[model samples]
Target: MKIGVLMKQVPDTETKIRIKDDASGIVVDGIKWVMNPYDEYAVEEALRIKEKKAGSTVTIISMGPKRSVETIRTGLAMGADSGILIDDPALEGADCYATAKALAKVMEPENFDLILCGKQAIDDDSAQVPQMVAEFLGMPQAMVIDKLVVSDDGKKATCYRRIEGGAKEVLEVDLPAIVAAEKGLNEPRYASLPGIMKAKSKPFKEINLGALGLKAEEVGAKGAKLKVKKYFLPAEKAPGKIIPGEPEDAARALVKMLREEAKVV
Candidate 1:
């Protein structure tokens, strides 16, 4: 089986983000970058499937600035056979739809048997790309998959996913399907020294919008249907107020504060 996993590089959650002066985007300077956390789950699942079904190959794909190569390398180090980096200035500032369109273009010739992606990227949290990619490819798609298993013939797979009211739904899909993996599917493994060394020797294909026969107007901010008008840090949290006394007194004080100050009681 040839499985393709879509990965993304995002600012580390710990990094302090600053909006650009013009409000066009965030200032990414000096911010540490890492693989999207949710994507890690997808990669891990792919690796697990490869392990279970020996002879399977896992390829990672990512689209972003040059720095995103590091994110691809991270996946390679985790045992993905190879990677492709779709780099182009035109791809910058793209929203979910444009990004998905670019990915679909690149994946058209790969003849992949499966496509895996995170349920949502942490940076945008839009949760739109996977479905869009599936739509572009005209493939069946399963979202928020918590568990998965492939049939012995590798032609069909089953998945358990979360639904409304905390229900779990089971789906059976044929090969060449797209699945958006959720957290807790499996624990991801860290890259070892040997894996890292081998990753350096693996193929890393880089393609640009021009190479893909796409125009600048089809990607980036111009193609994005949504726009960010402003960006700013959230307001600082207020200090907590403590009520000290016996349980009865504390409860009374809490009730009084809720009724008078919060007006929620």
Candidate 2:
């Protein structure tokens, strides 16, 4: 089986984001980057699948600036067989559709039997790329799946998708389908010392638009239909008010505030 896992590099969740002065984007100068937390589950799931199927290979694929290589290397250390990084100046600011287009273009020739990715990247939280990639490749896709079972012959995949009310929707799709992994799918493993060392020797390929057979106008900012007009932080919340009196008095005060000041009653 050949499995391809889509990966993304995003700002660490704990990092404090600051919008750019011109509102074009976030300030990246001092931000620490890490693999999208959701993608970690996808990587772990891919590794598990590879272990169960002999002669299987897991490849990590990503699109971003040069710094994204670190994210791919992290996946390599997590036991993916190889890594492919799509890096090009023209790919900067590529929106979800363009990103999916570029990734689909790259993977079509590889002919992977299965594709997996996180439900969403944390940075933008768009949650659109994986489905778009599946559409571009003309493959069926199951999103936010928490459970997966591949057939013994590796010709089909059964996925359990979590929906509202804690219900799971079971879907079975033929081979060469895409799945967007959600949290609770599996716990991601840390890179072992030996694994890290071996990752350095693993096959890693970096390609650009030209290599992907994509024209400059077909990707990146030029190809993006979505545009960020401006970014602004949410308005600061007011401090809470404390009603300190008898319980009965406090209850009455709270009710008053709810009905009058807050006007929610």
Candidate 3:
């Protein structure tokens, strides 16, 4: 079995974000970057699958700027066999569609039996790329899966997914399908010293748009069907009001406020 994991580098969730002066985008100068948290879950699942299947290899695939190589290396340290980084200026501001197209191109030759990725990237939270990649490859896609069991022959997969109203859905999909992993699937492991050292020599390949036979105008900001007109921080929330009075009076006042001022009742 050959499994492909789609990874992404994103700003650390704890980092404070700043908007650019011109309101065009977020300030990246002082931000710390790390693997998208959900992507880590995908990588861990891929490693688990590789362990169960003989003669199996897990490949990490990503598209981002130059620094994305570091993110790929992190996956290598997590036990992925190799890494492929698609770094090019033309993909700077590409939308989900353009990114899926580029990634689909890179994945064509590999012909993986299964592809896994996070449900969404934290930065934009679009939750669209993996499904789009499946569509491009003409394969079935199972989204937001929390549990997965591959057949002994590696020809099919049974997946468990969470749904609305606290229900779960079980699905069976053929091999060579896309699966978007959700949280609670499994806990990710940290890379040890030896794994980190081995990652340095792992098979890592970097490719550009031209190398993938993609045109400059067909990807990145140029090919994006959606564009960000401006980016501004949301307005600060107002402080809570405290009613100072007797308990019974306060309760009456709160109900009055809810019925009148807040109008929530």
Candidate 4:
């Protein structure tokens, strides 16, 4: 089986952020970038399936600037056979649709048995690209997959996913499908020294818009249907007023606040 996993590089969640001067984006000058946490789950799941099936190959695909190679290399160190980097200056500031369109264009010519992605990218949290890719490819898609099982013949796959109100649903789809994995699907593994060394020697193919035959107006900021107007941080949280008293007095104070100030009771 040749499985393709779509990965993303995002600002590390722990990094402090500041709104840019233009209020159009966050300042990333000093921020650390890492693989999207949800994508890690997708990568781990793909690796597990490859191990179980044996002789299968896992390929990691990422679309971003050259810096995104670091994220792809991380996946390679975790057992991916190779990586592809779709880097182009014109691809910067692409919205969900354009990004998905670009990815679909790149993948259509490849011989892949399955495609995997995180439920959403951490930076945008749009949760729309996977469906868009599936639509573009004209393939069946399953989202929020928490469990997966492939048939021995490799013609069909079953997936268990979480739905509204924490309910789970089972879905069976044919081969050449796309799956968006959720958390609890699998635990990611750290890169061993040998794996890292081997990854350094693995193929890392880089392609651009020209190579993919994408028109300049078909991607990036111009192609994006949505625009980021402004960004700002939420107001600081109000500090709670501490009430000093015995249990009865504290209870009375809480009730008074809830009834008067909060107007909840």
Candidate 5:
């Protein structure tokens, strides 16, 4: 079995973000980057499958700037057999649609039996790539999955997808399906000293827009159908107010405040 896991490099969740002077995008300078947290789960799940099935190989694919090679290395450290980096300056500001198109183009030749991705990237939280890639490839997609099992013959997948109101749906899908991983599927393993050292020598492949046959107008901000008009942090929340007095008096004051200050009565 060949497992294709989609990984992404994103700004660390705790990193401070600053809007660019021209408001074109976030400032990348001095910002720390790491693999998307949910993507980590996907990689771990792939590794688990490979452990269960003999002769299975896991490959990691990522599209980003040159630094994304570092992210790919991280996956290699976690036991993926190989890594592919789609690095191109032209892909800098591409939105979800164009990004999916580029991935579909490259994945066409790989012809993987299973594709795994995070439910959503932490940076954008769009949650669109897995579905879009499935659509582009004309394959089935099971999203936000917490459980997954491939049949013995490797021709089908059974998974449980998360739904609204904290519900889950059990589904059986044909082979070559895309599964978007959710948290709690499994506990991801940290890279050990040996794994980290070995990752340095893993087979790495890097390609650019030319290799993917992508047009200049098919990527970056120019190719994005959705544009950001403004980028700014949300306003800080106000401090809580205290209602002081007897229980009855506090109740009356609360009613008054709701009717006048909050106007929700």
Candidate 6:
């Protein structure tokens, strides 16, 4: 079995951000980058699948600038068989669709039996790439997967999906499908010292857009179907007021505040 795992390098959650003067994007300077937190779950799940299937190979794929190789190595250290990085200056501002399209093209010839990704990248939180990639590859996709079971023959996959309001949905999907992993799917394993050393020798392939047969205008901002008009932070929220006294009094006060000061219903 061949399992393809998609990971991304994103600004660390704790990193302070500065918007560019033109609002085209955030300033990269002084920003620490790390693997997307959710993608860790995807990598862990793929490694578990490979462990269960003796001949299965887990390949981690990342798309970003040169620094993304560091993120890919992180996955290799977590036990993925190898890593592929699609690095090019043209891919700098690729949106979700372009990203998925490029990744689909890169893996189409690789012929993976299954694909996995994080439900969403923390930086953008768009939660759209998995579905876009599935569509581009013409495969069925299961999102927010918290549990997964592959058949002995590797022809089908049964999964439990986490839904809104703490609900769970069960799905039985065929092979050659994509799955977006959610939290609680599995605890991600830390990279052991030995594993890290072994990863240093793993095959890490880097290819440019030309190698992928993609032109500069066919990806990144030029090919992007969606556009961001402006980027700005939300206004600071006002501090809350406490309602004192008994339940009945507090309820009345809340109603008054909503009807007058807050003006809601």
Give the alpha-carbon lDDT of every model. Answer: 0.92, 0.94, 0.95, 0.91, 0.92, 0.92
Compose the digit string of candidate 3's lDDT tens values, residues 189-252. Answer: 9988899999989999999998999997898899999998998888889999999899999999
| Native RMSD of candidate 3 (Å) | 2.7
Q: CA lDDT of 169 in candidate 2? A: 92
Query: Each model's TM-score, in the order given?
Result: 0.92, 0.92, 0.91, 0.93, 0.89, 0.89
Q: Estimate the overall C-alpha local distance difference test score of candidate 4.
A: 0.91
Please give the ranking of all candidate structures by TM-score, highest first, separated by commas.
Answer: 4, 1, 2, 3, 5, 6
The alpha-carbon deviation from the true structure for residue 70 of candidate 6, after best TM-score superposition, in angstroms, is 0.6
Candidate 4 local lDDT, residue 69: 95
Cα-lDDT of candidate 6:
0.92
List model 1 lDDT by residue over 103-200, tens digit each. Answer: 99899899889999999999879999999999999999999999999898999989999889999999999988999999988898999999988898
Better of 4 and 6 by TM-score: 4
Tens digits of per-residue lDDT for model 5 on 9-120?
9999999989899876789999899999999999999999999999999999999988999989999998999999888888877889888888888888999999999999
Model 2, residue 173: distance off in Å is 0.4
Model 5, residue 139: distance off in Å is 1.1
Clash pairs, candidate 5, are: none
Per residue, candidate 6 scores C-alpha lDDT tens digits across 72-115 of 98899989989999999898778999999999999899899999
Q: Model 5 TM-score?
A: 0.89
